[model samples]
Target chain A: MEFGPHLLLATLEGLVQASVLTLTALGLSLVFGVMRVVNVAHGEFYMLGAVLAWFVTSMIGGSAAIGFMAALIIAPLLVGLLAALADWLVLRRIDYDPERTIVATIGLLYIIQQVTLMTYGPDAHPVAPPFNTRLALPWFEFTDGGLSMYWPWGLSTTSYKLFVIAAAIVTLLALWMLMAKSKLGLILRATQLDGETAQAFGIPVEKVYALVFGMGAALAALGAVLVVPIQQAHYLMGDDPLLLSFIVVIIGGLGSLRGTVVAAILIGMSDGIISVFFTPTLAKILATLLVAMVLVYRPNGLFGAKPA
Target chain B: MKSKTLLSAAPTRRNVLTGLAAAGAATALPNFARYAHAGSDAPIKIGFQVHRTGIGAAYGRWYERTTNAAAKVINDAGGINGRPIGIVAEDDGTDPKRGAEVLEKFANQHGCDIAYGTLFSHVVIGSAPRAAELKLPYFVVSEGHHVASGMLNRYTLQPGITDVKSQVQAMAPFVADNLGKKVTMIYPDFAFGHNHRDFFSEAIAAQGGEVIAKLAIPPTETSFTKYFPQIPRETEVIYHVMVGPSVLTFVKELGEFFGPSHPEIFGFIDSLEAVDFASPGLEFLEGTHFWEGMPRYAQSNQTDADKFYRAAIGIDDKGASLDDPKDVSTYAHMFGCWETLYTIKDGMEASGYKGPADRQSLIEAVEAITDMPEGREHPQGAKLFNGKTHQVFGPQYISKVEGGKLVVQHTTSIEDGLYPDEVDYTAQSF
Candidate 1:
C-alpha cells in the first residue's frame, strides 16, 4: 500500500525482466560482435526455446522439479544445436551476406514459427516452477532503539522471482568468464578481430561462426527456459523478446557485449516500472523513442568501437 | 396473331443464333431455363472464411471442423433443396486485410452464395464492408457487438452466436448477486474488449453493482504481473477474459500474484478454452467459475443434438478428443459455426435458392427466421434472432471448474439478454 513497498515490488519485477533481457540481448550482441550478422529471427529462437522446454518437460513425465531441471539443462543445448544446424545449412549457403542474411533469418523466423505452431498447436502452455515459496518481505522503520524490521503487510514476493534474479547474475558471471578467460573465447575474439587472418592462422573461421551462432541461440534459449515458468509458451511469443533484444543491442552498441547487458538492464527496469505506473503502450513508445534518439546522437552505440 | 406468325416463320440464321444463346443463358443461370431443376442439382457452394494462421487460429481450426461436420450431416440428410452443400474454405490468416481479401475471393473467385465463420471481432469488422460492397451475405460467428451496434451494413448478420452485449447483459446479474458488487475487468485491449467494458459497465450498473477498475491489456502481451498491481485493493471480484495465444500465462500470472488470497475470480472460458484444467499451473483455478457460451463438458441432461455433434467432431464428453486429452476443442465458441451453417441451409431452403440469382432471396429468408429451437439444428441452445439487429439471443452457461473439469451450474434464459433493438437490418434493405 505504501509507496516504498510498491516501488520495491516494481523493482523486483523489473529485475526479473532485466535478467531475462540481459541473457537474450547478450546473445544478440555476441552474434553481431563476432559474426557481423543481424539475425532477425533471434526472437523466434527465444520462442523455440520455450516451446522446446515445454516439449522436453512433457516428454519426461515426473514431478515439476525434475521436468524443470531437465528443461534447464536440455532445452538450451537442443536449441543451440538446431541453431548451429541452421547456420550450417542456411546461413552458410548464403555466405552470411549481411543484407541477404537478414532476409534469410526472416524466412527462418517464419519457418520456425510455423513448424512450432504445427507441432505444438496454437495454445499458450504454462510450465511450473521447481519451487514457489511465498516469502513475506520485511520493511524497516526507525524506532527509539535504532532501526527495526517489521513485516510489510500485503507487500511480498515469491522465492521463485528472487531465484530468477540470482540465477541471471550467476549466468552472466559465468558467461563473462567464458568470454574473457577461455580458449574458445580466444578463437572467437580472434575471428571477431580479423576473420581472414584468423583463418590463415588456422583458427577454423567457419566453425567458429557456427559455434558463435549456436551459442548465441543457446543463450536465448537459456533465457526462455528460465522465464517459461513465469510466462506461457506460445508460438507468437518471440516477437517482443526479439524487438527488445534488438533495441538493447542497438542502444548498447551493436557489437558491445558489456553495453548490451547495461542497455538490457536500463530498458527492462524502465519497462517494468513504467508499465506498472502507466501503460504498457506508453512504455514501449518511450523505449522506441529512446532508440531513435540514441541512433541520432551516437550511431555506433555506447560502447561500439570507432571505425578504422 | 401477327407476332406469332412472325416468330414461327423464323428458320433464319438470326433466329437460330438467338435461340441457341437463350438456351445457353438459361443453362448458366439455372432458374431461367425450363431445365432449371435439372441444372439446380449441382452442389450449393458456401465460402468458409477461416482464420487458419493468426491469433484466432485455435478457434478457426475448431470452427472449420464444426463447419465440415455440419455440412456432412446436411449433405447426407438430403442436403438443402436436394443439392449437396459444398464448403469452399479460404484461410484469412486472422488478419483483417487478409479477411477482406478472402471475402473478395469468395464472391468473385469461388462464386459462393455466402461467406461465414470469421471468429475474431477485428477480422469481422474489417471484412464486413467488403462483404457489403460485394453483397456477399456475410454471416459472422464472432462475439463482437459490431453487427448489433449497427456499425456494419445490412448484408452482414450474426444469427447463430450471441453478441458480446447480450452475453455480458445476461452475465451481470449472476456476477452481481453471486460474486460481488465491486468488479475489476481485465480484458484484451481491442474491439471485443471495448464491448465487454461498455456493455458490462452498463449491465452491472443496472444490477446495482459498480466496476471499480478496468484494465485493458494488449492482446499480444506475454507477461501480466506488472498489470496486476494496478487493480485497486478494494476490488472484490476480478473479471477476466483474455484471448489470443497467451491466455495460459494471463491466468497463471494472476494466480501467482494473488496466491489464494486474492479477490473472487470469475473469468470467461476464453482464458482457458484450449488449456487443460489439470495442467500444473492451473490448479489454482479449481473452484473458480467461468462463463461459457457452451459448456465444454457434456452435462447429464445433454441433448441428443449435442451428443451427436460431439461424436461427429471426435470429441468426448470432456471436450477433448477420444485420442488425446490435450487436444481440447473450443466448445464455448465453435458451436456458432455449426449452428450458422445449419441456419444458412435453412435460409437457402426457405428462399428456394436455385443459384446466384437467388442470393437476395436467401438473405430475406434468413432475416425472416424468428426463432431457432434447440435440436439437431442448434446444439448450443435455442436462439431468438432479432431481424432488426441481425443478432441472436441465446442462453449463456456458467460453469465451475471442479476436479479438472468444467461443470455447468447455471444457464440464463434468452429473455434475460434481450434489449431494445439497436438497428434493423431488414429496414436497411438487401
Candidate 2:
C-alpha cells in the first residue's frame, strides 16, 4: 500500500481505538473528579459489562440484532448496580479514603475476576455484532491526467466498528449533558467541591458519592459493551483497557473530562501512526516514553489545576 | 547389702512388665512390616503444574480435563505397576516465577514421583531448571523447541508433542507448493513466534520460496487492522500464527481488512484453538488453511485411536465438550496432556518405578523410548520419540475451513517433522 492509503487506514483504526479509550478514560476521570477516589477495579467493571453482554445475548438468543440490542441496555445497567453495591458494602466503610479505597478496589478487582472465571470459564467468548459489513475505503491520488480515487487493498473498516465509534460519541455526549446541564449534576458537583458543606446543606453526600461511583463504572461498561463485538470478552481483557485508561487519565490532567478525551485521541492516534513508521513493540515503548516525559515536565498534568 | 534388698523388693513387678513389653514388640513387628508393604501400594503421585489462573487458563482447563481423563483410563486398566495414578495438580498462574514455585511445591511439598503437564514455553523454561536441580523428571506438553534446542536440562523432556521448530519446518513444503511461494509472515513478537519465523523462513527457502515481509505484532495488541497495511502488495500468501485471548479479534480484523479479496492465508490453529469457527467475523475464514497439531474436527479418515481419545476426553466430533457444544476444547494442543500421561504410564511401567527413589530410572526408561505406535495409549498418531533430544516427532495435520468446519487437507508423515538433534539429554547426568 502507498503511504497515503496506509496513513489513512491507520488514522481510521486509531479513531476507533480513541472512541473506546475516550469513554473508558472519561469514567476514570469522572470518579476521580467527583469522589476523589481512584477505583482500581474500574476495568473489571468494563470486563463485567462485556461478560454480561455475552450472557445476556446468549440467554436471549433470537436474531443477532435483538440479542445485541438487549445486551446494550442490560449489561451496563447490571454492571452499574454491581459497582454501586461494591461502593455501599466496601467503599462506604472506608469513608472513601484515597489509599484505602485503592486497596479495596484492587481486592474488588480480584474478586470480580475470580468470580467471572468460575462462572464464565477461561475462554474468550465473542458476542455477535447486531450488524457487520465491510466498507472498502477509497484513497485519492494525483495522476498525469487528473486527480483520481481508487479503492486500496486492505483499506477497509467494518460497519460494526463505525457503530462502536458513533455509539461511544453519543454516550459521551449524554454523559457531558448529565454533568453540565442537570440538577443531579449540580448536586454531584457541589458535593465534589465541598463534601462537608454539601452535607451541611442537606445534599445527601454519601448517596451522591455512591451514585457518582456507579455512574463512572456505568460509563466504562457502556464502552465495553460497544467494543465486545469487535474484541471477545475474556477475563484478562480488562488489563489493557485499565492501563490505557490510566495513561489517558494521567496525561489528560487527572480529572478533566475535556483533557481526557483530547489525550485519548492523542495517545490512540499516535499508537497507530507510530506503528506505521516503526515496529509495534517500538511504538509501544515510544508511547510509554512520551507518557514519562509528560509526567516529568507537568506534575499537575496537562490540564490539572495548580495547587491552591 | 542395700542393692540386694532393692532387687528383691522390685524383681517380681519388673519381670512381669518386661515380659509384657517383649510380647507387644513381637506382635507389633509383623504389623509394622505389613504396614510398610501397604505403603508401597499407594498411588503414584504425578504433580501436574497447571496454568489454572492466568493467560494460559483456557488451554489449562482442557489440559486438566484431558489429564484427568487419561489418568482415569490408566487406573481403570490397573495403573502403572499396580498402583493407582494420583494427579497432584497445582496452579502455576501461567507466570514463570509462579511456575518455578509450583515445581518446588511438587518436588518437596506434594512428594510427587514425577512432575508433568506444563504448557507455555516461558513457564516450562522457567521451571525446568528447578526440576533439574531437584532431580525431578519434568515431562512438559509444551510444544516449544526449548527442550530440543538444548536450552532446558536433561530432566525436562517433551515426549508428548512435536516442538515448534519441527512443526514449522513440516508446514513449509505444503505452504510453498500449495498455498503460495511469496509469503508474508505475521506472528507474535516472542520466543515462540521467533521460532516460527526463523525455522519456517529457512524451510521455505529450501523449497525455493521466500518470505516477502515479516510483521511481528506485539503480544499486547488487541486490534490488528493497522498492521495489515504493512503486508507487501506482492505477497502471495499471508502466514499468521497468534496466541492469547485477543487471537479471535486478530483473525476477525484480518478478515474485515481484506473483505472479499486477499492472498491465500495459512495459519497455526493456535490462533483459533478454543474459539468456535461459527464466530461472526470468522465467516471470512471459510477457505483459509491452518496447521493443526491434531485435527480439531474429526475427519472422515479419522483413526480409531482418535475416536477413543476424543471419547475419553468427553469431546464431541466437532471437538467441543460433550456437555456444551459451544465450549470448544483446545483439540490441537490438549491431546498432548492425554498422550503425555500415557507416556508417563508407559515409562513408569517399563522402569518398574516403585517410589521417588526410582525417579532417575523412570527418566532413563522414557529416554530409551522411541517409535510409539498409534493405539489406545498413543492416540493422536504414531510418534517417533527422539530420546537424545527429549522431543517427539509426529505427523502434522493441515486442514482447510469448509462450511464452518476444519477439513483435513494434508497430513505430513512423521519423517517430514524430523529435525537434527540439538542436545543429547540422555548423555547428561541425572
Candidate 3:
C-alpha cells in the first residue's frame, strides 16, 4: 500500500525476471562465444524444457516436490542432448558457417515448434511449484518512540519465487566455476581463443564445440524448468524469451558471459519495474531504444573483446 | 481408439434414429424427396476454411474433428439432397492474408458449393469480403460480432453460435450480481479481447457496476505477474479472458500473485478450454466461475441430445476421449462447427439446392430458419436464428469449478442474450 512496500514488490518481481533472463542469455552467450554458432532456436529449447517439465511431472505422478525436483534435473539434460543431436545432424553438415547456421537454426526453430505442437497439442499446461508459502514482508515506520515494523498488506511474495532467485544464483556460480576451473573449461577457452591451434594440439575442437552448444541449450532448459511452474508451457511460448534473450545478449556483448549476465539483470529489472509502474508496452519500447543506443555507441557491446 | 471403435461398432439403426431424433426438429425436416434426384450420384463439396496452424490451431483441431463427425453422420443417413456431402478443407494458417487466400482457393480452385468452418474472429473478418466478392456462401462458426453487426455481406452468416457481444451481455449481469460491482479486466490485446473489454464494460455498467482497471497484455506475453501489479488494489472481481498458447501461465501467475486472498475471479472458459482443471497449481480456481459457450463437463441435467452428440463425436462426459483423457476436446466452441454443418444441411435441403447455381436459394433457405430446437442437429443447445441479422442466439452457461470439475451453475435463456437487430442481412441485396 505504501511506497516502500510497492517498490519492494516491484524489486522482487524484477529479481524473478532477472533470474530467468540471466540463465537464458547465458545460454545464448555461451553458444555464440565458444562455438561461434548463432542458435536461433535457443528459445525453442527453452520451451522444450518447459514442455518436458510438464511431461516429466505428469509421468512421475506425485507431490509437486518430487515432480519439480525430477524436472529440474531431467529437463535440462534432455534439452542439452537434443541440442547436441541437432548440432551433429544439421550444424555439422553445414560446417557451422555464421550465415548458414542462422538460417539452419531458424529452420530448426520452426521444426521444433511444429513437432512440439503436434505432440504436445496447443494447450498451455501449468507445472506446480514445489513450495509456495506466502510470507508477508514487514515494512518499518518511524514513530515517536522508535521505528516499528508493521506487516504491509499486499506486499507478500511466495517462497517459490524466492527459491527461483536462489536457484539461478547457484546455477550461475556453478557455470562460472565450470568455465573457469575445469579441464573442459581450459579446452573450451583454448578453442574460443584459436580453434585451428587447439585442433592442431589435439584438443578435439569439434567435440568442445558440440559440448558448448549442448551446455548453452542446457542452461536455457534449466531456466525454463525453473520458470515453468510460474508460467505455462505452450508451443508459441518460445518467441518472447527468444527476443528478450537476443536483446540482453546483444546489449551485454555477444559471446560475453559476464556482459550477458549484467545486461539480463539490467533489462529484466527495468522491464519488471517499469511494467509495474507504467505499462508493459512502454517497457518494451524503452528496451528496444536502449538496444539501438548500445549498437550506436558500442558496436561490439559492453564486454566484447576489441576486434583484431 | 477404444471409444471410436465402441461407437462405430454400436447398432447402426439405433445411432441413425437417435441422431435424427437428437436433431430436435421443431421445424419440419426438409422434404428431400424432390431434391434427391437433383444430384443423386454427385458429391456436394463444402469448403472448410480451417485455422490448422496458428494461435487458433487448438480450436481448429476440434473443429475439424467435429466437422468430420457431422459429415459422417449426414452421409450415413442419406446425405443432403440424397448426394453424399464432402468436406474440402483448406488450412488458413490463422493469418488474415492467408485467410483471404484460402477463401479464393475455396471458390476458384476447389469449386466448393459453400465455404464453412472458420472459428477465429480475425480470420472470419479478413476472409468475409473475399467470400462476398467470390459470391460464395460463407458459413462461419466464429463468435465475433462482425457478422451480426453487418460489417460482412449477405454471403457470410454466423447461424450456428452467438457472438461475443451477445455472450458478454448475457454474462455481465450474473458476474455483477453474484460476484462484485468493481471489476478489473485482464484480456489479450486484440479484436477479440477488445470485444470483451468494450461489451463487458457496457454490460456491467448497465447493471450498475463499474470496471475499475483494464489491463491489456500482449497476446504473446509468457509471464503475467508484471501485469497483475497494474490492477488497482481496490478492484473487486478480476475478469480475465486470455487466449493464445500461454493461458495456463496467465492463470497460474494470477494465483501465485494473490494466493488464496485475491479478488473473486470470473473468466471466459477460453482461458482453460483445452486445459485440465485437475492439473497442478489450478486448485486456486476450484471456486471461480467461467463463462462457457457450451458447458464442457457434462451436468447431471444434461439432455439426452447432448449425450447422444458426445457419443457421436467420441468425446467422454469429461469432454475428453474415453480412449485418452489427455486428448481433451475444445468442448465449448467445436459444437458450432457441428451445428453449422447441420444448418447447412437443413438450408440446402430447404432450398432444393442442386449445385452452385442455387447459392442464392441456399442463403434464403438459411435465412428462413427461425428456430433450432434441442436435438441431434442442434446439440449445443436450442438457438433462435435471427434471419434478419444472420446470427444465432443461444443459451450461455456459467459454470463453477467444483472438486476440479466444471459444474454448470446457471443457464441463461436464449432471450437473455438477444439484442435489437443490428442490421438486416436480408435487406442487403445479393
Quote each prediction's TM-score.
Answer: 0.91, 0.93, 0.90
Model 1: residue B14 alpha-carbon error in angstroms: 54
lDDT of 1 by residue, B1-430 (tens): 3343326764667678888999998777522123334476777878899878778877888898889988898888999999887788888988999999999988887677788889999999999999989988999999999999999998999988999999999999999999899999999999999999999999999999999999999888888888887788888889999988778878877887777577788999998877778766677888889999998998889899999999988899889878887888889999999899888888988999888888888889988999999998899989999878889899999988888888888899999999998787788866
Candidate 2, residue B344: the lDDT equals 89
What is the per-residue lDDT of model 2 for residues B1-430, given as tens digits with 9 covering 90 to 100?
Answer: 3354424655667677877899998885422233333576778888999988777888999999999999999899998899887888899988999999999988887777889999888899899999999999999999889999999998999999999989988889999989889999999887788888999999999999999999998765777887888899999999999988788899988988888998999999998888889877788898999999999998998889999999988999999999999889899998899889888888988999999899889889998999899887887789999889999999899999999999999889998888777889888887
Measured by TM-score, the strongest candidate is 2
Off by over 4 Å in 1: A136-156, B1-38
Per-residue alpha-carbon lDDT of model 3 for A167-218, expressed as tens digits? 9999999988988999888888899898999999999877787788888899
Q: Interface RMSD for each candidate model?
A: 2.2, 1.4, 2.3
Q: Following a full C-alpha superposition, what root-mean-square deviation does model 3 have from the true structure?
A: 9.6
A-chain TM-score, model 2? 0.97
| lDDT of residue A298 for candidate 1 | 91
Worst lDDT run of 10 residues, candidate 2 chain B, spans B29-38
Winning model by DockQ: 2
